[model samples]
Target: MLSLLLVALLAGSGAIGVAAANDAEREDKPGGAATSQGPRNRSAFSNPSGNLSFARQLDFKLGDGVFRKLWVAAPSSTRSSDGLGPLFNARACQACHLKDGRGRPPGPEEQPSSLLFALARPDGSPDPVYGKQLQTFAIQGFAAEASVQISHKPRVITLADGLRVTLQQPQYELRELAYGPIDPTTTLSPRIAPPMIGVGLLELIPEADILARADPDDKDGDGIRGRAHMVASPTNNGRQMLGRFGWKANTASIADQSATAFLNDMGLSTPLFRDGFGDCTAAQSACRAAPDGADDDGMEVPQKLFDLTVFYARNLAVPAREGIGAPAVRRGQKLFSDIGCAACHVPRQVTGASEELPELANQVIWPYTDLLLHDMGDELADPGTPGDSRDGRLWRTPPLWGLGLTRRVNDHDFLLHDGRADGVLQAILWHGGEAAKARDRVIALRKVDRDALLAFLESL
Candidate 1:
């Protein structure tokens, strides 16, 4: 029996339907057979997929080594680990994605390691001197691009029940400019490294299934228009494919994402990005002239090593949902649908066939995202880049699996692209544009109902 209020809420928000209250009492494993049954602690996100075969486990371990391997300056005795950076953010993939979980913005006076700045012009061009990303670290002979400082301004919102929740709005500034002043019009978008859970399964989701959910014109008048981000596939010879990864859905594959990070974050050239200087612009001549770590193949990271890192990233398992049978969590699940959050934060998706990794094939999983681009409104928008007209306003809906383990795995619960929101509640509060109607519903909920909603989210 549905409550009249719940039914009206669903109808108004265009939600198809939600499971019965008691249905959640059944054990719900969000990641299908790939879900990790690891202990609920700091190591929760570091486990391999539960269904991975014994032989494949060795490959996962080998990949883990490459992920945590540290790189140093060129001409070092450790030939394989050289080519760190002329200007880079971190020495290793593990440095930014600490403990294989989400990264946090640095506190005042702390130099950013996980949090880095992206520099670009209105036309999506890199800053002439600083290039694409602002690197705060450099090798001995080269100067780091610049240091960054962050400050917070508190903004308080009063809920319908008159409870006040204060959110910290972050302000960023660049200091110690070694490459001279950057272009005045360059947009500085701060990005925090996201978690590495259930990405393999996400990569395996059928493109047709995701495209079927897109309603770009909002012809149904649901006020929720999700559009797919079409990107040129690097492996497919410039063929346009659905962009599945990254904050703006700008990247199409995990392998591509890993290669980009290797170049930009560690200044290590891979087979995909053969630039020895990484993001160093031609304007920085000293960086271009610096010694490189290229091996016989003329790439810092050889193909074999690169493949291992990608495997590690692709196989990080999503942890099983906790506290699902609780009454409050069940109530919250219904409210999540009733309030329209489920419209975009889609609760379930089935991965298509994967010949490469058969364990991930044809499995029902719960990642809680449509993997579509939505206009998130001005509050969350970065500066517009000409490359994509919707660059500023649109963002990919990030998967919500393993979100509840943030504090345990990473010691922080910062959410959103820039890590401004402190917790799930604040993240929801910051939603706008296509999500504004749903955000309003959450704000107007009774305190008990609100608590349940949060409970359901935490259980995911």
Candidate 2:
């Protein structure tokens, strides 16, 4: 039965093609034509798509400039860079996503820039006082919303071979409240900045293909029920579209994600989120009265600059896989599929057509995510919202394309939505609900097989 399942998975992953050698070679380039054959260092995630035209190279560079550009308080002589914050988290996109990689949780004494807290009431409305997110930074003369502190409680799990793995259960506390006391019913969700590789390609994945894999009712009785997160398209005139980005799969497109980050993280106005006083509530009159950095068009980030930034985000390339054909990696790969990890982290997806970005269109990519929401069980659940049916238990399956390079790119191996897991193994162990069986299988694996499984993930 296990052998049959392995064969079925291999066939589904296109690993059993007529030209097996050719297929193996193709797997090494997980991003297809867009994969960056790399310098293989800290700058690995910073490259443009491999197939991007030379003519468009300058545009990508300009977009990088916009992403790394720092913001300041309004009324400054640097007209283009002003409009920072009444209350915000980071000054630039790069501040959180340093080197275009993952964001780490801040140390005990450090103030958070990349790890942010999102606040929502039971009915999916912003907190009445602190607004949608908690901002730790404020412009001069303004009180910041709050100070965030994280502490961990140790949890040790003994595996089948009696190998004990310790996991840190993170605890978040808000201190130094600036505005007022938060409503007791508000739910706080901590989010780490996810890596920004192959996002454009993810956007190009056909909605039909994604929905085709969703088993919301679990009709097959596999206990893995992935559901599509339907959200209103911010740019498509309120058209409901598949939600593919963010920890909760709340945002629908790369453009929307970029615009949202500009507003919430940096307190800069974008075309999508037009409010210059980002995250400041109506109750906070002082924040609302603060001066903004809007230009003649009444926007902080103008259309041209916003377009460049979004383009840069969309074009960031996925690095090519390293050491894919090694004996351990091959074993690990087979084990990964056999253990049911691929049920949600479906390995292969072909991007749909895109005339505007031809290089990304119709390419086979290995993002290792079904891009659907799943019940992650109680351990990882955020505080429940009263009227929300999901009750904060469902989380989007983040892509695993750049799983191996976390240490090189960010100098840390913080994983998962809250950066609670210290490594790949810990992240997997934390899985529950639909992934509970897979997690148990991993725990039951012999040490060698477990190591092989991790090796396969790292080769991704």
Among the numbered candidates, top TM-score falls to 2
- For residue 89, what is the lDDT in candidate 1? 93
Steric overlap count per candidate: 0, 0
Query: How does residue 270 of candidate 1 score in lDDT?
Result: 91
Candidate with maximal lDDT:
2
Computed on alpha carbons, the lDDT of every model, listed in order, comes to 0.85, 0.87
The whole-model C-alpha lDDT of candidate 1 against the native structure comes to: 0.85
> How much is 283 displaced in model 1, in angstroms?
0.2
Model 1 lDDT per residue over 1-460, tens place: 4576775454333343543342233226667888886877899999998899889989999999999998999989999999888788999899999899999998776889898777789778889999888899999988989988788899899999999999888888888999899999998888889999999899999999899889999988999899998987765666888899888887789987898899888899998888889999999998999999999999999999999888888889988877787889878877888898888988777789978988788877778889999999988887744245337889889999888889989999999999999999999999999999999999999999999999888877
In the range 1-460, model 2's lDDT, one tens digit per residue, is: 8766665566455343222234677778878999986767899999999999998989999999999998999989999999998789999999999899999999889988889888888788888998888899888989888898788899999999999999999888888888889999887788899999999999999999899889999999999999998888777776889999988888899998888888888888988888899878899998888999999998999999999999999999999987988989888888887798888888888899999999899998888898999998999897743223345889988999989999989999999998999999999999998899999999999999999999988877
**Lowest-sum lDDT 10-residue window in model 2:** 13-22
